[model samples]
Structure formats: structure tokens, C-alpha cells
Target: MGISRKKIYEEIADLIMQDIKDGVLNPGDQLPSITRMAEHYQVSSASIREALNTLSVMDVIEVKHGQGSYIKERMPLGFEHEFQIITRKDIENLLDLRKIIEVGCVELACSHADEEDLGRMQDALGKMRTAVMNNELGEQADYEFHMAIAQSTGNQMLVDLLGDVSEKMLETMKETRRIWLYEEKKSIQKIFDEHQAIYRAIAEKDSGNATGAMMRHLEEVATVLLKQHK
Candidate 1:
């Protein structure tokens, strides 16, 4: 049988992980750009992004907005077992729930967000735009953007609820975002544009538009990711 794309990416992730272990890629070292890595590995940019996504989620790397991927300051002590347990089904379920929760969050933000809240969202989006311009992944800024919206609700319970799931949600975000950005062949600019649209709606206090934009962003990521899994 032909090699599956999933297996190919997993192997690429493993190779990078091994490089870390062998001191070839030391802690805090910035990795080559996805384009360069793809050229070296003779793989597609999507595969490189998948490998980086897995590493980021595993705590083996940190993807900083406006900068490239870096080896973590401290590697995860025990991530292999946990990583193995997270199936595509788990991500799909989480995306379904994220759509429900975050769309509501954005609607509330549109209704109640203050200037400070809008400023925070705008800051996150700015970082995301810079990351895109530099050909970097804006995973952390993406999380902050959504969290800022949740905080704008002025509902502590909702904020706490999302904070409780922050770890898993982070991993889910990295996966879904990479799939949408690279696997779906969507541009990084598109990701920033989608978030910008949501921010604009909230800034204008348009609850209907805010929720609709948020839903579309989440659903597009989910749709592309699930389609790849199939």
C-alpha cells in the first residue's frame, strides 16, 4: 500500500524529536523555516507544519508569534503516552464544543467588551499578522485572541471554564490551525483575516456578525481537518 500522509508526518515529527534528543537541535534553538525544512526533507510544507504542530503540542517546541519555532526551554517530562492518547476524534469533538463555547463568547464580547478588551484583542491580532508576515506560526497569539474574547464577557465563570481547558484547547488549536493553514493550502494571511473579521465585529458591537464570524473560523478549521482525516 502507498504510504499514508499521517504516517509520513508522524515520522517527520519523530525525526525532529530524535534530533532534539541527540543534541542536534538544542533547547532554545530556533528551527529552520517550514519552507527550508520542506526543501531539506523533500516533503510538502503541510507535512512540515504537521510535524511542528505535533512538537509544539508535545512541549518539545514553542511557536512564538513573529518569530520561528524554538526548542522548549525545558522539554516535557512525560508526553509520549499522553500524545498517543489524543486521537483525531478527540480533536473533532473538542472543535464541536469550541464552536459552541467560543461563538457564544464572541457574542457576549460584542455586547460588553470595553476599550481595554478590544485593545487586547487587537494586540493579539497584530502579533498574528506579524507572524504571518515573517512566515511564522502564530499559535500563541491565536490562543490569546480567543481568551481575550472570553475575558471580555465579564463573566468569571466563563473565563475560568475556558482556563480549565486551556491545556487541551491549546493542543487542539495548534492542530486545527496547522491543518487549516497548511493542509488545506490556506494562506496565513487568511487566518489573520478571519480573526480580524471577528475582532472588527466585536469592536463595532455587532453581536450577530461577531458570532457568525467566529463560527465560520472555527467551522472552517474543523471541516478541513476532518476532511483530511477521512
Candidate 2:
């Protein structure tokens, strides 16, 4: 008989719980960023995010926009209980939420993003191009650039929501990125093209055009990710 183990994220969550019990992470202290947690755990950011999400849902920790996750000042009741493992379906739903929220984010960004925000988006894109050219995963740069767009909306809630969505897509993004950059040996120029279109629309303050570009870009990416999983 085979022994069934906890999901990776569940295991990660339990480790956090242990840290809590050991007084390693004190109340009101911010946890490490998701990327750092992933590195520490030798796991994907998706797993770390899922673990954090479980804690957040349980009211044990707080996920604040812009700032990292934090230990709640007051521990929620039943903090000793086990967390339900996040499954593939949960990730899919998170992605779906991203699609819905980000399209709206781009629209709001068109009207709200200032010169500095747009410039930062451009800078992030440059970093992404550099990462891709060097044959690196570029996942960090990619996530940053996308998060910049969400931040541009000036809606903290939307920014926070998309931040969670970014992690859920991490694994799928890696697979599709490999297929696009290595297996097929295709230029990721299309990615730049789509991002450029979206950026230009936002810079021009063309809400309608920005929304359309974002929709098309995300829809195509979603299709590619789904195909890879299939």
C-alpha cells in the first residue's frame, strides 16, 4: 500500500505553523516575500502562495497589498486546525479570477496611471527582455511587470487580488515558457508586441483600446497554458 502525503503547499503551510509555534515569526511581523519563501522551501512560488492563501483564508495571517504577508496581530481561533490542501481546480479558479480582474485593471490604469507608473512598466519590460535574451526563466521580471499594470489601476484591492493570481499561474507559466522558448525555439517577440500594444494604449489613455489589448493578450496566454496542461 502506498502512503498518501500532504500536498506541497499543505506541507509548506505546516512549516509556517511550526515557525509560529516556535516564536520564529512574531506577531505583526511581515513574512518573507513569496519568491523568498519559494527559495527557502525549494518549491515553486505557486506552492508558497497557496500556503499563504490557506493561512489568509483562515484569518491566521494577513496578505496586505504592496507589503508582504504578515502574521496577524491576534491569532484567529482554531489556528491549530489543519488546512485543506489546495488542488488544481483551485489554481484554475484563481487564474480565471485574474482574467476577469486584470482586464478591468488595465481599463482603470488607462485613466489613472501617471508618467512615472508608465515609465516603471517600460523599465520592467526591458528587464524581461534581458532575462529572456539570456535564456533565463524571467518569471520574476514577468510577474513584476504584470503586477505593475495592476498597481497602475490605483485600486489596492485589485492589486492584491492579482498578486495572488500571479502565483497560481507560476507553474503553468513555466511550462508554457519552456515550450515557447526552448522546445519550439520560438522568439518571444510576440510577448513584447502584445505588451507594447497594451502599454501604448495605457500611455495614450485609451481605455477602450487598453482593455481590448489586455483581453486579447490574456486570452491567448490562457489558451496556450491550457493547451500545455492538456
Candidate 3:
């Protein structure tokens, strides 16, 4: 049997949820209009509107009358009302998925990266170094460096996915850093070294090494998060 409209709505809801959880739809970001979303998902506008309304009721989004639907920024609470819900496991799974995708991206980037890509990466690295030395604005530089790598892949879909993953990781890292009472120096240096390793691998067009380096870096970060949570 063909999938029912209810099932289609659920599928759309799930995709939106994944995007939200990954931070692609940031707080206050307006979603596409119902008609646009409906067209994209090959569903009725009414179904899209219903899904948005459901999300709004769950506090995952807000729909303003005569305005549009916007993502909400509330932190997920455990065992709360249906409004806000997320678990530690969910965060871990997201991080794992990010690592998998990033490994592939690094491989592709190494194969396709150009001089302009290298230049942009160098700029990001320079900013990161300055931020580390000056003890200011490190987070932004760190994000830029990773984003540069994602851009090097020359794949819009991968770039977009990384953007979403990076945003979530940034928020989670901020919280993890606070909880661990960690200083930025050692972490920054470690990340700088890993970035250098990845850059060198890409420059040499060593896809295997590029993917390995990226995975190692992600594993290190994951280890830190797990330890902090423990």
C-alpha cells in the first residue's frame, strides 16, 4: 500500500526534528513557508501546516499568527512535559553520526581541494593561532577552521550538513567546557595540531590519511565529552 498522509507527515516531522537537533534550524530561524515545504516534501500544504502546528505545540517551534514558524531555543529537559525532550544518548548518537560523515568529507576534500580552499584554511588556522596566543575569540576561529575544511570538499550538501553538525557541537562543547572547568590553552593546541595534520594530509592528496586524521580528531573530542559526562 502507498504510504498514508499521516505517515508522510511523520516522515517530514522526523526530518525537521533531525535538522533541529543538529542545529541547522537555529533559534529564531524561520522555517520555509508551508507551501514551499509541502512542495519540497511532495505533500499537501495542509499536512505541512499540521506538522508545523504539532511541532509548535511541542515547544520545538513557534508559529506567529500571520507571520511564520520559527525555531525555539529552549534547552531540552529530561522527563519534562512533551514540550521539551532530549537525552544524553541522543547527543552522543549525534556526535557519532557527525564523526562518520566528517570522515567521508575529509576524504573527499583531500581529493578535490584547490588552492583557494587551501588559502581559506590557512586564514582560518592563522586566526586560530592568534586567538590562542591572545586568549580571546578562540571559539569563533575554531569553528571557522572546521568550516573551512568542510568547504574544501566542494560539496554543498556536505557543507550544509557540516554546518548543522558544527553548530550543535559548538553548543555542546560550550556546556562541556563549562562543566569540566577546562582551560582553553591545551585544548586549543591539541586542535591546532590536529588541524595541521589534516591540512598536510589534504595538501598531499592523501585521502586515507585525511580521513584517519579527521576521525582521530573527532574521537579525541568524543573522548573528552564522554569523560566529562562520566
Number of the predicted model whose lDDT against the real structure is largest: 1
Clashes of 3: 0
Best-to-worst order by lDDT is 1, 2, 3
lDDT scores in order = 0.78, 0.71, 0.69
Question: For model 3, what is the error of residue 148's alpha carbon versus the real structure, in angstroms, after optimal superposition?
Answer: 1.6
Note each model's CA RMSD in angstroms: 7.8, 12.8, 16.5
Model 2: residues with Cα > 4 Å off, grouped in runs:
1-88, 183-186
* Candidate 1: tens digits of C-alpha lDDT, residues 125-147: 99999888876668889999999
Q: Judged by lDDT against the true structure, how good is candidate 1?
A: 0.78
Q: What digit string (tens of lDDT, one per residue) describes model 2 on residues 116-226?
A: 899889998898788657655565666777788888888899888776666555644544454454323344666666777888989999999988988887776666555
Error of 3 at 20 (Å): 30
Q: Could you tell me the lDDT of residue 127 within candidate 3?
A: 81
The Cα error of candidate 2 at residue 152, in Å, is: 1.1
Candidate structures ordered by TM-score, highest first: 1, 2, 3
